[model samples]
Target: MSSFPDYYALLGVTQSATTEEIRQAYKKESLRTHPDRLTKASSAEKKRATEKFQAVADAYYVLSDPTRRSEYDVLYASQPRRSQDPNASSNFFSQFANMFAGAAGGSGAGAGQPGTPPAGQRPDAEGVFSDVFEELLRPEVERRVSWWAYLGAVCGAGVGFIIANIPGLMLGAVAGNRLGAIRDAKGKSVAAVFNQLGGNQKAEILRALAMKVLGSAF
Candidate 1:
């Protein structure tokens, strides 16, 4: 029998993991395997990371939704055990690739298609994965930078006007935009650092970020 991709194992989660748990697992796995985080890696390593990243995204999308998760759970339960087989890993990924390729309607038809995912299962599979990647890498405070920059410019202008006069408005806008850009850079730096940390360290950082987000929400 062919081996199936173990979504739970891929994300390091249990089959019984809660939705929130699965979400958290995806965040952890996605960050670790993100291709951008492996710029210094060998070509092969980078390719592997990219594939793993896509797989992680696919697993999260499937497991996060109720209906899909239920379906996956059943399939997973029914798949025969091949953990002892050395070929299990390769077989799993082979099927994984084929699954997405089929989703793209096969090689002949999909080859000419632009913006098609390497193993795209659905027309928008790549799009969904992109969204997930963006969400995962986004800085805590910089989630909506465009909106924040606009608001910041307005506020900065108001503050500047009170301090100075006509010239202050223009100065304030430039300053606001500059400050926004700086913060965004800092956020990116933080994410980079987070990516380099050990597993336990990452968990701590993720926990802190989660707490801060939750605190602000309430």
Candidate 2:
């Protein structure tokens, strides 16, 4: 056995404990020894609890992964037993600190490397809009528009024109006035209205608006 604290012992689990058992033990130990749980304790007690909590977390991080666990098991088995070293706890903590420092340094280096945009420089608004637009249009583009929709709108307008040419214009003007009043009451812009629509509804509205704009351009 190694002079270092046994991870399994820290978690209160056996060497042959299953992954789920190890996870449960870690969760139980972590909650019990967490610094927050020592709110009423003395300063010394709180500090000790914090250290124990960190150790439990670190142990779980290593033991939960098969590769790391295997490596640790071999290294642990090869070391002198805990009884042989009076300074075993200090030695274990020193090694743990070095391991944590190395991990942090590696993470920082990877995050700051060239060819990757820094966190502050990354595009957010434009990227989100582009993603949303692409997703919304995907189904519409995949499934061709039905001719019946165009035909229905055309026939409805034609019938209205035939029935009362002058009254139809007056009626359209009244409807437009009512819609404007509703929009003003809501205090919502065209973009806000479009955003409130479901995906399919938005796609249809956008397609019609886009076609109207393009048609006027020609």
Candidate 3:
């Protein structure tokens, strides 16, 4: 009968949202609810914004992490439905922490030895990257293609022929195809990928890529 914050709903994203989507939503929501942005607000408004900001941060911390997100998704699916109350927002982190503690205690394992996710349930880097590319880049490629198609149709056959020969269009097509091919390629282990990079390096790479994708979106 325990209640949990619906991280997906809190972030204004669907359950199937990609990591990039989740990250974008988090950035948007966090900025909107940030206390600094509420300097002119009433005391009650600022307090509400703080609570919402914390909730969004917690949601991003969980959902942006592959393993934690998968575990949470499973737990979320098994829970019965309940309307979220204001108190739930304030207590979200503490409640989630307790749930993890209880899980570890019941498993009779140290926190360092968190139990494995169910078979085939673990999120792999390939899948994560695939989702990122598809969510972030595919639409961009399609949009560009559509724009060119429209321009070609409007500018007559000569311009249409020239547009068809544009290198940017071809490069976009190649990039889109390569992204799918790389993501679909098999045999690389997630642990191996992480091991090759320092922790900070991995984080920086992800952050840089996220920024690049987010920048491209607008």
Candidates in order: C-alpha RMSD to true structure: 10.1, 20.1, 15.2
**Model 1 CA lDDT for position 21:** 86
Off by over 4 Å in 3: 82-86, 98-218
Best by lDDT: 1
> What's the true lDDT of residue 191 in model 2?
34
* Model 3 lDDT-worst window of ten: 107-116
Q: What C-alpha lDDT, on a 0 to 100 scale, does residue 53 get in candidate 3?
A: 63
Q: Which stretches of candidate 2 lie over 4 Å from their true place?
A: 83-90, 93-218
Residue-level lDDT tens digits of model 1 in 94-171:
454444443443332223233244553422333443344444435542443345567677878887888888788888
lDDT of 3 by residue, 1-218 (tens): 35667878877899889977887786655545444344357888978766666666656656776666777778788877633443464455445554443233232111122222222222222333323234443433332233334443334433434567565555545555544445433344343343344444444444444556445211
Worst 10-residue lDDT window for candidate 1 reads: 106-115
Error of 3 at 216 (Å): 17
**Each candidate's lDDT (Cα)?**
0.56, 0.48, 0.51
Q: TM-score for all predictions?
A: 0.48, 0.41, 0.44
User: Whose lDDT is higher: candidate 1's or candidate 2's?
Assistant: 1
Name the regions of candidate 1 deviating beyond 4 angstroms. 82-218
